[model samples]
Target: MKRSEQNVVARSSLPWNHSCGSKSFAATMSTKAEIPHFVDFFKESHWSKKKDDWLDHKCMEKHGELENLRTMCSQPDAIPMSQEEMSVAVLGKKSGYLRGYGVGRKPCNTNTTSRDNGEEVIILREELSSLKELNDTQQQQLEAQNEQLAIQQQQIKAQNQKLEKFQEVLLRCGLLSSDECGEESTEGG
Candidate 1:
């Protein structure tokens, strides 16, 4: 065989096949592993656009019901409840349901808590602190802007008063009376 044809055969017979196959499989398995267990909870059910519409309808109904409950509770005759009782009534005993399904769980404490799979808790306290600082800065800016607006209003009021005084002086001096001023100047001349 020619040198080019021999090179092609050598390349085709390389161990790249085994390495590539294993790497691809490992990548696929890792991706699948990252999916939350809650996704499988609804897998058996047919997920269609209609299901999403139904969920939206249910959410609206629940919101309306909560609003009605709030109005009722605000009445003078309504019974008062403690915070714990209110929480129990609103959230029920299934508070850990999300954690059970591996969805929306609170971030694990880096200092003490440990996940079964040994994943490190991603600490974002520094990021959160920076965000809070940004919010405070924004609030300060808004307050400063309000104070500046008030100062501008006072300045505008002062300017208006000064303009009124100037007009009054002009009127008192008879300078505002064009015809009278003209006739007086003509008689003097």
Candidate 2:
């Protein structure tokens, strides 16, 4: 009947079905709400107190068997790209939001795409070169070790020859018995 009453009927999405018994009841059940914006984004959101609530059904059941992941999705980098072109470069083939699209599989909108550039390849090249250099150094060290081993073997061979000659001389001079040299002692006593 009034402007406020008319406004209430016009604004309300649903029709007023229930008949108010009292004037106070009708006053309390008006179309107007304290919240100026009727559309509440987080009005129906529920907060999870437990960590296992976020996981998949199977994972939730077998929490102990599998790794308890903090998040299944990959986290984005911290780099900021303010410009549209930078956003385009960062986003790459996944610019549906900026370009305008109704429905599409959204690319992982993480800043980790910066690594896909040539700069990362250059970094990888440097790492590979350094590893190769280290390998060469290790190879050289191994060769040096082999040379030292060969020298020691030659010295041992020379000493062994000298000892053999000394043993022969001792046997000839009757200083060491043949039995004492290698064979068992001949004298039973």
Residue 189 in model 2: lDDT = 15
Candidates' lDDT values, in order? Answer: 0.48, 0.44
Error of 2 at 147 (Å): 0.4
Task: Report the error of model 1 at residue 60, Å.
Answer: 46
lDDT of 2 at 140: 100
1-189: candidate 2 lDDT, tens digit per residue:
999999787747421211222332224324336522111101111112344242234323232221112122123644533323332332234434431111232254334355455567898999999999999999999999999999999998887778777778899999988878664222311
Q: Candidate 2 — which pairs collide?
A: none
Candidate 2 has what TM-score? 0.42
What's the TM-score of every candidate structure? 0.32, 0.42
lDDT of 1 by residue, 148-188 (tens): 99999999888767766665677788767756555544664
RMSD of each: 24.7, 16.2
- Candidate 2 Cα misplacement greater than 4 A, ranges: 1-115, 183-189
Q: What is the lDDT of candidate 2?
A: 0.44
> lDDT score, residue 129, model 1?
81
